[model samples]
Target: MSEARPYGFEVVRLARLEARLVVYDWAWARDNAERVTENWRRRVAGQPALFDGPVLLACDCAIVGEVCRLSLFETTYARFLAYRDGGSPDGHVANAFAAIVPWSADGAVLLGRMGAHTANAGQIYFPCGTPDPGDVRGESVDFSGSAGRELLEETGLDLPEDAPEDWVCLRGEGQLAFLRPVRFSDAAATLIDRMETHAIREDEPELSGIVAVRSAADIDAAMPGFVRAYLASAFDAGARARRRRT
Candidate 1:
């Protein structure tokens, strides 16, 4: 059998409620797990000094007609693990980005599923802006651009030009704030209408589908506790703004 090609990030599909990722790997990740973990740790440390903790690397290999390797490196210390190299004084960050938690009208949240090219499919959130390897520092995809890019790349959604602009950045208590944008008020409704009337292409073999949750409680119920907490803060900020206007 031919060796699997090196892995690269790619969006397989986009659903009204979630986006799917496909991370491909033919060999058992275990062979390079430790080295990969250490390399990531070193990378993290070299970035701006932030949190502290042992970075935990978790991964899985799925064999479904094809072999795929999934890996995750997580740490509780927000500073050490969550900080990106772009924000660091020294250069060297991964050329990867994610849409953290995307929301639809009626407060339904979108999540992504893992596929042949993904580490793990999880809930969708705010679309984060990031720079390519050669791009200038701080030059990232704006909120609108990121959302549109993610929607198109993941789900092939040609979102209308009149998408909403309610968003927030989830930085540390006071360190740096990462922006999260909501493209539409009725994103779920818009998505449902699209799915029902639109024709979906199956050319991509990586993404599975997007999943939606109706309420904050529903999101918490479907996702990990930590994820729930992270999402809550974003939603809470929006709620607070709404309350102020009222």
Candidate 2:
């Protein structure tokens, strides 16, 4: 958790992302609802308030210069979960999550273990969440605000409004994760200790604990695939740089 090796990440930010609803896949949704409900009941004890929320599914993405142009459409949370859990094959619905890879000055990366009561219990990932209605500003998505809010809410750490940023997007299966790398002045141990304390002291905290990943070997099965993928590339770059320095 305490090392001085630099992560050397290029920070990215998403100033604005467009989002909107699409044509109803009534036939698919009708068939998918029952399975989604049952699966939800199994995975989540009791019921979380189900809403006809907008889930941003990526229909197409192309890099136009540095910006990624994503064709996104909206669907309900129920339908999104169905596609997420593989109960439905409808690629029409995609879940979009925004997160920041918090890197300590000492090169350690902090991750969070989700609390049991949460939907992704025991799963480890960077502090992030699904973009909700509040994230919608006018007709555009506020990715930076969402990432900043989630980081503060979960770990009690805040990145300045003017923090340097770069948008890094990753996709797998039917899901897309939009990530921003945020650097912290704190060392890894300090951040981990502070986050762990926050998780314990906060009321009904969403995170169970903080995990410090210093190397690719530190990544475990509990972490989401996207996290492991990102860390692997980062650590590999660090290793190569160190080798060259030596």
Task: Name the best candidate (by lDDT).
Answer: 2
Error of 2 at 116 (Å): 0.3
- Residue ranges of candidate 2 with Cα displaced over 4 Å: 1-27, 44-55
Tens-place lDDT digits, model 1, residues 1-246 = 112111211112111121112233323233444544564576555543323443322222222222222222332233223333223222221123334355576777665443443322343333232312222113222324544565556554565566544333222221222233444456686765553332245454224555666545555443433345445554555688999999
Score every model by TM-score. 0.44, 0.82
Candidate 2, 21-93: lDDT as tens digits? 3334445768767887776666555435334466555556554445655555555666667667783376554
Q: Which whole-number lDDT from 0 to 100 does residue 109 have in model 2?
A: 89
State each model's CA lDDT, in order.
0.38, 0.70
By how many angstroms RMSD does model 2 differ from the true structure?
A: 5.6
Stretches > 4 Å off in candidate 1:
1-34, 37-102, 122-144, 159-167, 172-179, 183-190, 193-200, 221-227, 237-246
